[model samples]
Target: MLRVAAVKSPKIKKIENSPPASPPPSPVQLARAEENRIIALAKLHQSRTQGLFVNVGPSWMKVLEPEIKKEYFQSLCKFIASERSKHTIYPPTDEVFSWTRMCTLNEVRLLILIQFLFFSVGLCFSVKPGVQRPPSLANMYQELSKDIPEFKSPDHGCLTGWASQGVLLLNACLTVRASQANSHKDKGWEKLTDAVIKWLNSNRSGLVFILWGAYAQKKGSFIDQKKHCVLKGVHPSPLSAHRGFFGCHHFSKCNDYLVQQNKKPIDWNMLPAELMKENINIQN
Candidate 1:
């Protein structure tokens, strides 16, 4: 045997294990998400007015009825003052006061009762529009939750609970004339709504949606139904509610959907009505 080549073989290096690279989003998904993002940004922030882009829905404008008597609003001013004096409580946000003026006492009461209930809300309509207000009623979000819990006596509480729960309260039409229901019919509200839908489809998934009417259900097709909970029923109004809304038990149903998704159930209860009596406006 030739001893001329006794050099040690070069040591072999072992390759360390590493995480596999994540696959890139498919072209379809990428295209969809990007397209959605662009549409959402434009929808929420941009508009075409008289062939020019106008900042319509995103930055709310308060166009109070120029025709209504000052006394109608003055009544609200008085009511607001009375509430403040009676409970030493005031609307937490300017929106609280403004929407309260638009809402009935029962509506406000219902608004406060959704605290311990569903963690999300889906709406068929925007609350209202005004010169200084966004086309949506998202501003009164906080005050709506100051009063109720999800478990018992759940109410709409100015939709504050839904607002707090990050609900998507959308409207096909963004601008409604104060006294006219169809004033904004031709104002391109449908396009604005499409933008919101695209934004939702792109930005989030596995959410709970409340589709309480034909109009709401119509929008359902736009959402990612595969990844979200879509709850449907009649509109929450006396006219159609008898068709389904009353016994829908949507609050509990919504919470149930949340739990199924491995989410913490909405903290439907606030302090017992007696404990927070002072700050609450519902105490008799």
Candidate 2:
């Protein structure tokens, strides 16, 4: 009983605390993201490669007909043989069969046949110019001259029916070629359109597409028309300015639009008054 009366319990204070925060994303999460990015890149590359084969392969095959006859088959055989000496890179069954097939074809006969067919058509046209007439070469040249006035020689005053300025501008600024009726047949055009679309998708930027003629207008429809600002007009024939293809008052408005956007003008030397006014507006 000596000090029991004065003994007292120590007071305890409860420490208030916040819950533990989640740890930063672990190394595993970072590695997974990297893996996904690599897979995406691989898929994109595969898609591009397949697209190239589908659009361009047949045209390339036709163009390479000569090379195929002379050296391609033999070269493939040699490469396969070389690869076989090392560990097999290609399937053995497929390689052996393909090599055997290549060696059996009569290359010389095929070449002669193609050459004969080409010359025979030339001979037939020359012999029967009237009854079996395809368009005359001279008439064809004349029509082309009309379509492209720049073809007029210096001695020729203006080539009677041709429109000079419009043809010149069109040729200089835009290339219009005869494409196959089937859009799929124009591989170069397809590839260019595909690339532009891909770039736009990735960049999320606005694009302006200028279509100069009916043909181009039709082709533009195949693309993602909504994604870009498309400006369509006639073929820029000399008549276009008078007919108000886009607008007579602003014949060169497209050029002005481009310049204001910090883009290059279609033709700097031929800047119309409307374009100059736009330029002044931009400066002010």
Candidate 3:
């Protein structure tokens, strides 16, 4: 038996008082950690989904410090937010799929530009990725060209073919709410719209701008009339279709302009083929 020290050593006192090293996170703690991981992954997937055509937030969000990452994640989530998630507005990372406004090797003269307020329907992507247009917009596309005037979920191939052949579907506001009612009302939208218009107007000309309705027509004001063909009319909404939209003969007129410009007319029929039959690329 060791003799008791007149006074306990400071070392012994420290050891006894320090308290047992906190046990490794409890089973409960481990479970909570796993749950957090799952949540993080889900949030990332949502961001990527909303991004469309481009892999925006998900891929890189992991590397940022927690605070900064939260900022962007919250921003991107705003467009897709439900009543619970809406917060600060953030710029979108993806674009609706399309070729550059200035495409070369086109079998045509210049791109036919169709302007919209914003993407009325969210762009859908899959392993075989593509965009899904709203019903009215789809009808507008069919009216422009094609025999069958309908498709369920339009694919990327349709858009790719149009871009490849010679069409630029430009939206005045590039990003909008997932909800249609308040779609492009946010303050950031017009700033984005101005940038896109400026880009199109800069170092480009002779583009055919199809400005349907008052809003799209207004968006075209900055585009030089000397450089582009501004085809304006009532919008393609069911409400406005009767207001000089039906039988406006825009498709034929667009082709006519292209032909007059000495550039090959776009194969409007191509989109119909690609949209209805996903496996095929639209040709002639």
Best by TM-score: 3
The global C-alpha lDDT for each of the candidates, from Candidate 1 onward, is 0.39, 0.30, 0.47
Residue 206 shift from truth in candidate 2, angstroms: 4.7
Candidate 1, residue 43: the lDDT equals 52
lDDT of 3 at 25: 94
Model 3 TM: 0.51
lDDT string, candidate 1, 11-119, tens digits: 9999998999999999778766755554465353223111112222211122222211234333433443454444432112222222222322221111211101111
Ranked by lDDT, top first: 3, 1, 2
Per-residue lDDT, model 2, residue 45, is 34
Instruction: Give the poorly placed runs of model 2, Cα more than 4 Å off.
Output: 1-194, 197-206, 222-228, 237-251, 259-267, 270-284
TM-score of model 2 vs. true structure? 0.26
lDDT of 3 at 82: 46
Ordered list by TM-score, greatest first = 3, 1, 2
Q: For residues 129-233, could you state the per-residue lDDT of candidate 2 as single tens digits? A: 122223322332343344433433222111111111111111110111123112112323233333323433334323344455565565455445454445565
- Provide the global lDDT of candidate 2 against the true structure: 0.30
By summed lDDT, which 10 consecutive residues of candidate 3 come out lowest?
A: 275-284
Instruction: Using lDDT, give the best candidate's number.
Output: 3
Model 3 C-alpha lDDT per residue in residues 1-284, reported as the tens digit of each score: 99986975566434456667877898777766765664566466545545422422222122222422344435534544442256422224433322232122222234333343334222211112344455555556546544233323343324544544545544544444444543545424344445545555654566677777776677677878787677888877778777787778776777787777777776654544342221111111
What lDDT, from 0 to 1, does candidate 1 have?
0.39
Which scores better on lDDT, 2 or 3?
3
